[model samples]
Target: MIAQTLSQLRQLKLTGMASALQTQQEQPGPYEGLSFAERLQLLVDQENQERQQRKQERLIRTAQFKLKAHAQGIDYQHPRGLQQSQMAALLQCDWIRKAQNLLLTGPCGSGKTYLACALGHQACLKEYSVRYVRLSRLILALTQAKADGSYGKLLKNLASFDLLIIDDWGLEPLKAATRNDLMEIMDDRHDQSATAILSQLPTDQWYQSIGDNTLADAILDRLMHNAHRINLKGESMRKKLNSLTQAEHLG
Candidate 1:
């Protein structure tokens, strides 16, 4: 009878509940005194927890973040101008729910990408869909999408994510086509979805890097307005870590 019930639970796709039932059958002593209603509630709670875990895993896999970072793993001791209170607020993901943007700017190797990825990870935990892509690659992909006649579809897909992270912003001058593509993306996400940009270049230099006053104004207006800014300042974290590793080897 127990085997048949377990089989039925599996067939019904209540795998978590099925596993819990099997455990209960194997070690009945723990739950022997509980009422049927209480035991059933435990099974339901396990099923809900398992479903939530699977969803979080799927969301993280789809995010494709460059670094495997978590909000809890952020190195606040790195002296990169990261404030604990600010990060705490960001981790709550209220900004994402409100459709706000984030800007992270700093010198190269100052942990900008890591911080962005950490926030992306946190957003995933909060059940928000996220995607991380470098600006150069995004532009290339947009150009390819245009050639392959999927430009509109691509735009819609890009705009669909709850959090869109663009790294390596303002690395080079943007061509006219790239500017227009960026315009389309920013316009679609404007006031509707959240975006996070990681850049080595400061925000002030972004206009010159874009090379078009009109397009820069439009793009910056959408991204910069109501955006949370984090300007990091410190020595290159990469080099610092390498030095520490070398010192440890010497010791």
Candidate 2:
């Protein structure tokens, strides 16, 4: 009867429950004393746990994060201006639910991208969809999408993600077409979805990079509205890591 039940569970795609039941049969000493209701509850709990794990894996896989980072991996020990309390609040993902934004700014190699990716990983763990794209590549892709006549479709797809991470922001000047495309993307997400912008340039210089008075104001207005800002200040994390590696080799 147990074998038949296991077969039926496999057929029904309750693999977690099936596996748990098999374990119960193989090692019945622990479960033998339990009531039928208690055993059934165990099976259900196992299935729920397996489902949650699968969902988290799927979210992380689809995120396409640049770094294998997580909330726990953040370096608070460094003097990077990162507040643990602030990060704790952000990790709760309330800002994402409220369709707010996050701005990460620092000098090159100061771990802005790493911190952004870490937060993004936390969002995925909470089952939120995420996408990481460099600003220049995003602009190039948007231009190609326009030529291929999928611009609107692409915009819709971009707007649907729970969190959109734009890295290397303000790296170069934006032309008229690029500015318009950015406006479209930002307008679609404004008050509808969350965005994370990682940049080496300070927030104040973002205006100069945009180069168009009217469009820059419009873009920054949408992006900065209710945005949480993190300005990391420290020696380059990359350089520090490289130095440590060299020291280890010498030792």
Candidate 3:
């Protein structure tokens, strides 16, 4: 009867339940002592756990974050203006749920990209679809999409993500066409999805960087109207890491 039950579970593709049942039968000390209802509950719990794990794996795989950053690993001790209380509140992912935007501004290596990616990772854990791309790369890709007649389709696909992490914003001046494309993308996501922008430039200079006053106003208004800002102020984290490495070598 045990063998038949195992075969049936395998045929039904209940691998988690089957594995749990096998362990229960082979190493039955604790499981044997449990009532039938408790044993059944244990098997169900195992299957549910397995399903949840698979779902989270899928979310992470599809997110495509440049860095594997997590909220737990953030360096609160660094002099960067990151506040633990603010991060704690953001970790709940209510901002994404509310379709608000986040702007992370800092100098090079101030952990802007890391923080943005960390928030994106948190969003994925909360089962929100996310995509991470550098702004320059995104613009280049969109330009190519335009050439190939897939621009509309690409915008739709980008808009589908619940959280979009755009890193390295303002790395280059935008062309007129790219500005238009950006406005379209922002419009699609404006009141529906959340965008996390990581930029080395301060928000004040963004208009001049964008170059076109009219388009810049439209894009910045949509992005900043309901946005939360984090201005990271500290020495470059990369330089600090390099210095530590040099010290270790000298010692």
Which candidate tops lDDT?
1
- Name the weakest run of 10 consecutive residues (lDDT summed) in model 3: 240-249
Which numbered prediction scores highest in TM-score against the true structure?
1
Candidate 2 colliding pairs:
none
**What Cα-based lDDT does every candidate model obtain?**
0.93, 0.92, 0.91
lDDT of 1 by residue, 4-90 (tens): 999999999999999999989999999999999999998999899999989999999999999999887888899889999999999
Model 1 whole-model lDDT (C-alpha atoms): 0.93
Name the runs in model 3 displaced over 4 angstroms. Answer: 245-247
Give the 10-residue window scoring lowest on summed lDDT in candidate 1: 240-249
What TM-score would candidate 2 get against the native? 0.94
Clashes of 1: 0
Q: For residues 194-217, write the lDDT of model 3, one tens digit per residue.
A: 999889999999999899999999
Clashing residue pairs for model 3: none
Candidate 1 is scored at a TM of 0.96
Per-candidate alpha-carbon RMSD to the true structure: 1.5, 1.7, 1.8
